[model samples]
Target: MTMKKLERFALIAMAALGAAACASVPTYVSLDPSLPRAQLTFHKGYEGTGLFSSAVQNYALGADEYCDSAKHAALFKNVSGTESALRVTPDVRTVVWAFTTYLNSTIGAGGVLGRYDDCRNAVIFTPARNRNYDIRQASTNGDAQCSLVITDAATGAAVRNVEVRASPDCIPRTKAARGSNR
Candidate 1:
């Protein structure tokens, strides 16, 4: 396989682990009424998968820096804001998003074992107090290229001075954390 294929495999594997971690996902902090706060509504519009396959996507919110995958173990919500909105303290925050599309090994459909492709990206910005923001992302060229948008909810305008950047290279998790016991 080419280098590109390896990258995709790493990401897909990570997202798959995250999916399992979601069963006992981490808990988000409650908003402190004393501190300034803002609301975020996440939007999901991923590339559709082929028939007989499944897709999984989630986001992780980290404060004051790009999401270090090593630090974030579980991926959060996959549903859009129509279900619920995220409340956060107003500060420099990073929204890390990722998704995986996979076909399970099965008896039918020319199965030669399972295969998958995945991508991850993030947006970092400081949200205004008491404002509502809509966040969305998309990827192309087999996860090589991507973009994220943050728009003002009331006016439907893109947030000014926003930064949308592709995710950095994946860093492997520590062995002890993975239950090596070595």
Candidate 2:
């Protein structure tokens, strides 16, 4: 490739990397009192509040990327969120993924390349029961914060609480019990 073309390519690649570094990552924390299995239904998106509500648009949930054993059931309609469900196994422990989007601007040389900034914030949480869940975002010192709330489907009492923070990275947890009813 010509030197000029190569230089431009290098610059674009660097810009992409920079954007990814700022993307949000989701973390999964396993709650105690393990059950054989459970169903998980959650909504992912900005809660339509705060200063950057509009800024934080088009949030996507990548289940397969973070949820090792997560199976996409269906998508429910939310005023400003995407809903999904996953059937989890006892072997899985932590579910991890990132919430990311591109930044766009109309004022400058980057206008043609309007969408330039990569925005991703890390979110981590655990499952408490097989029921409906609500996830919302909070603005903490300009950075978007994530919160998860799970409630019992029958009684409407809170079951598991989701928190956003940095934690030791983990992969899918699986176990094989050997012993027989034979």
Candidate 3:
């Protein structure tokens, strides 16, 4: 091989090795297992509010409730806030992933040259919310099943339906009961 080609190959190999060596083991933060509790909190915020009413109507008609303006507004607000918090929380796996992504994007070659290594880590560590499957189950069992309607507070239009679920338990089972039916 030509000297130039050999030099380029060496540089590429060195870069790959450096990245691997520098890459820290991604941490993960389990979602709040109390899905019921989280759903309750989410539901309470939607009650008596017209912001989600239209969205509820859409869901009833087999349409996408996310299209409702009121529901979208509420979702955007809540999700944005939650995402912001996740970015800053210390010792949190989600935060670490976010930080790593940010570094890769801004510090590295815009995260295009290298795959997004932290994407999965961030998702795994993200906190639980009413939108999650487990949280949805809790909401289905909670009062949300009965009071899922929401309306636009300003326009008095049915915006969407907010289903609140129950909180989840994060405790790990003991090894002795790991395989026991009872």
Candidate 4:
């Protein structure tokens, strides 16, 4: 091949790699304070079967981080702006780990297992509020996205919603710093 052709090929390949490396997913968080108890819901975007497992894992982690931060913030608000150590429920951790493991599996299918496998909108939690609550998630688009919603237990009304795009590093360093106490 000519030198010019070889150089052009190299450039195209580099551009493709760069684009893949820069890909990031969006996450959402919502909080409701109308009720007396607190509820948090997390949503993770769907990925194609062709995407790497690590990339999917990163997206899930980003969603978890969003929930983590919001959960803490809710407690702080409940306590009149006083911060405390954060602890995640075993069920929440298990759901996240299980989802990530499925993504890493050879049959992950990018969560496209039909109606049951549609992971574009997953209600990460209903949480243990004083009253019985139901939290559900639904995907509006096929693009990658993750979201978390928190609500008040008594009134079952939303308090806040935060949407964050998941980059390679995911959450900001400052959020990580704030979570150090946990």
Candidate 5:
């Protein structure tokens, strides 16, 4: 590679790292019982684990990037893991998207690329306080299609008043505008 290309790559990588640092949100830890909360489980299916696929090892819940600058401090994002269940305050909208693809990259000179042949599913919903919700992401049709399911973790019952969607869309939350400079 040329020196110019290397410098450009470094700059892009640094910018991405900086952005990631700025977007960081503390992981959910329900230490206080007094706080209104709900437990959630995140699951991700890896259809293509090799190159060309996204580097997203886990999906996140909550607005890690913040809904608006006005609610900057209110950001909450927890990545998927089996280490433990995550806690979420009721009434907060959550979005999760999983990339499932059968179009994995091949090795060698004859290797080709998959053009928009990937599969994915996204969901958005609000949890009830003190409830246990399970959010599962799945893929089918040779990983060409994706699916999402949110339900009670214990009873296996479908959650009420919640929408399970094939694509994600945040049901915009309202927060009063903060003070502005005079």
Candidate 6:
């Protein structure tokens, strides 16, 4: 082979090696078994109890397509506000993981892989009929249970039934600054 051709091949090989080296799957903590499992439903739009809105859902589906060969997982956290309604705070990093996992698996891998990507929506809880407080609060001493449901992005259907239990333990809170005056 010509000198120039050999150098070109070496460059290509280096680039491929670099790209492969940078390709890595992020790690996720195993779901907590002690937390109560909540049921999450994926809807076509923002009309119902689905975690993500239609636009977010579309993006998740796109991610699923783009990362079809990578493993992924999803994470959900709850944020507190003065309002009495139940609120869902979603972590985008977890959504990316879900997409990666779903994409890496073959079709119909079940909800286990797909549901990991459905962290786009926050499930809000409202008081039950004739109740004065949030249903979550009423049901469990103000502690709400969060659940994750995985589904196929292409068909908008469930892929598996791996139940993720949500408990107060999973919620992260901001710590007070040290050495600050009260």
Reference-based lDDT, each prediction: 0.53, 0.38, 0.23, 0.30, 0.48, 0.25
- Quote the lDDT for 103 in model 4: 24
- Return the TM-score for candidate 6, rounded to 2 decimals: 0.17
Winner of 3 and 4 under lDDT: 4
Show model 6 residue runs off by greater than 4 Å: 1-23, 37-182
Q: Global CA lDDT of candidate 3, please?
A: 0.23
Model 1, global lDDT: 0.53
Evaluation by TM-score, superior candidate among 3 and 4: 4
Residue range 12-119, candidate 1, lDDT tens digits = 654665557454335456477677788877665455433323345555566433223323322332222222356777765554444433333223455334555556
Instruction: Give the RMSD in angstroms, all C-alphas superposed, for model 1.
Output: 9.0
- Candidate 3 lDDT tens digits, 1-182: 44455444444543553345334322222335542311111121212212111111101010111111111111111112221111112222211111111111112344223222211111122223332211111121112233232333344454233322231112244556555723
From the highest lDDT down, the ranking of the candidates is: 1, 5, 2, 4, 6, 3
Each prediction's TM-score against the native? 0.60, 0.39, 0.16, 0.23, 0.52, 0.17
TM-score of 5: 0.52
Error in Å for residue 140 of model 1: 7.8
Model with the higher TM-score, candidate 1 or 4: 1
Which residue runs does candidate 2 get wrong by more than 4 Å?
1-36, 47-81, 90-92, 107-182
4 versus 5: better TM-score goes to: 5
* TM-score, cand. 4: 0.23
Candidate 4 lDDT over residue span 1-182, tens digit each: 44455444444443443344224322323334443443333323223332212112112322354434322111101112221212233223212211211122122346312111223322233245343332223222233443433344357686333232233222344656667846
Q: Report residue 27 deviation for candidate 5 (angstroms).
A: 6.3
- Assess the local accuracy of residue 72 in candidate 2 as a C-alpha lDDT between 0 and 100: 24
Lowest lDDT sum, 10 consecutive residues, model 6, at 97-106
